[model samples]
Target: MSDVLKLEAPLGDVIRKSKLKAIKSIVSSFQPINNDKIEFKNNEHSDKNISLDKIQIVANRFITIKRLGSGGFGEVYLAKDKNQNDLLIAIKFENINTSRPQLSIEKYVFEIMYECSYIPKMFYFGIHNEYTVLAMDLLGPSVEDLLNFCGRKFSLKTICMIMEQILRGIEALHNHSLVHRDLKPDNFLFGLGMKSHIVHLIDFGLCKNYRHPLTYEHILYRTGKTLTGTARYCSLYTHHGLEQSRRDDIECLSYIIIYLAKGFLPWMSIKNSNRKKRNEKLMEIK
Candidate 1:
């Protein structure tokens, strides 16, 4: 319910004149996810909307296997690297207009924190047809899934372990001048199969750099901006339209820890209440 305004223009178009060149800035910054056997076949239908049956190749390297999930931005599919031992990866396809900013932002953030053990590695980012696609390491089930398996609550020992990893991830992110606007159970994943115990922070789609790129000065505060991130875990300052800072990330992390420890937040049941009533109830809970 924050009032931050979002412009309805392509980020590449707003920031630079040439869309391809602007996108190339990120593409040129990193190596391909798999370069051994890239084979982008010329398809007359490349620009058409993507479907599982319709997709054969992505960036000439990964082939679609099945749809994994879909969100407001686009669809994610499980893909296999054709040249590298058929390595499994997740390919997220988002239409240019709706996904450009998020894709670009995520790539930029990954460029900064790719070495962090708690963060997923971005294998590649590029445009196919009219969609901006990102290929990243396929991770395992989220902590939210783990919570469900444990009957909606985490034991103190489990919560402590998970929180420790999460704190490390947050520290790594902050060390690079980034703030994860959305830090929730669903965004933290356990490694798949052999790497199960390793927790990774995923989905940088809502992350932002709190410091200026060049000067490295902290971004100044702004008010009345539209709310970003999940309402349940958003910092109280977010409710007042204040810009998110490193502290907000920590605050949201605190809320998540509280939820994991208690099973449910005190305000969860009153989420549907009117704004005034909700605020009053939340204040009482505080």
Candidate 2:
């Protein structure tokens, strides 16, 4: 299996007529080295639900300090690296028994996106008993939190600064032929404490490469891609069940900028009991 998630793409006139050599030339403009191969280690332990207070990640002794969040996948904790002057890190724990692929896919994407500074720094992945754990640099509050704090809006200067950081992150992703289908204020987080001005893009569960590696050909566009991102910020193509491309990310970011400026989207109040109806209404509003 390929490291990139396999999704059906739509066929379009532009994609059909694209010259392979020209596509390869454009891809060559970026500086991504091919390192798609990833291998994960499994821990030989009996306990599946790893208790942070009782255990530590192997290789590097990252001691758990407190739980940050938890959901169906597992728990995320704020931990300290005992060997590194109690350096803070975020560790996510997932039961190895589950069939969910979030942990594996996330690790894969992190490895491919490692060179991008705007992306989060992944320290390592390990197993604690029967749980698979991923450790990363702890980031600070998201733009969503900042928007709420400022009464749902930002000053002109702050908005410009934030958008510049976001565009840089998106450019990095596109340079690697990857498209971040899901984009919103919650996914763009500022670094914590001393790294405050630096913004990091997180959450890769919905990320995928949009071009073939060997041929550098654009993936054919496809339909029936389920709603893969936040409803309020999703692109019109997404609402229409069309394949998302690089432009979709830019479009979603534009919506986010509008939200930062106007507090809320005009379609925020539109509601329909049926999900499809809601999405259609959103498209109409757009």
Clashing pairs in 1: 2-226, 2-227, 3-225, 3-226, 4-225, 4-226
Highest TM-score: which candidate?
A: 2
Model 1 spans with C-alpha error above 4 angstroms: 1-52, 271-286
Off by over 4 Å in 2: 1-60, 71-73
lDDT of 2 by residue, 106-225 (tens): 676678789887887888787777777788888776777666654666666667777998999999888878887778887777665556667788766566677864677998888866
Model 1 lDDT-worst window of ten: 22-31
**TM-scores of all predicted structures:** 0.77, 0.78
lDDT of 1 by residue, 1-286 (tens): 0011022232112222222221111111111221113211110112224455576598789898877765434667878898778988877776676412345666776788878888777888999877788887777666666665455766666777778888999999888877877778877777654555667887665566688657789888888655566667878887676878899999998899888877789888877446556654664565
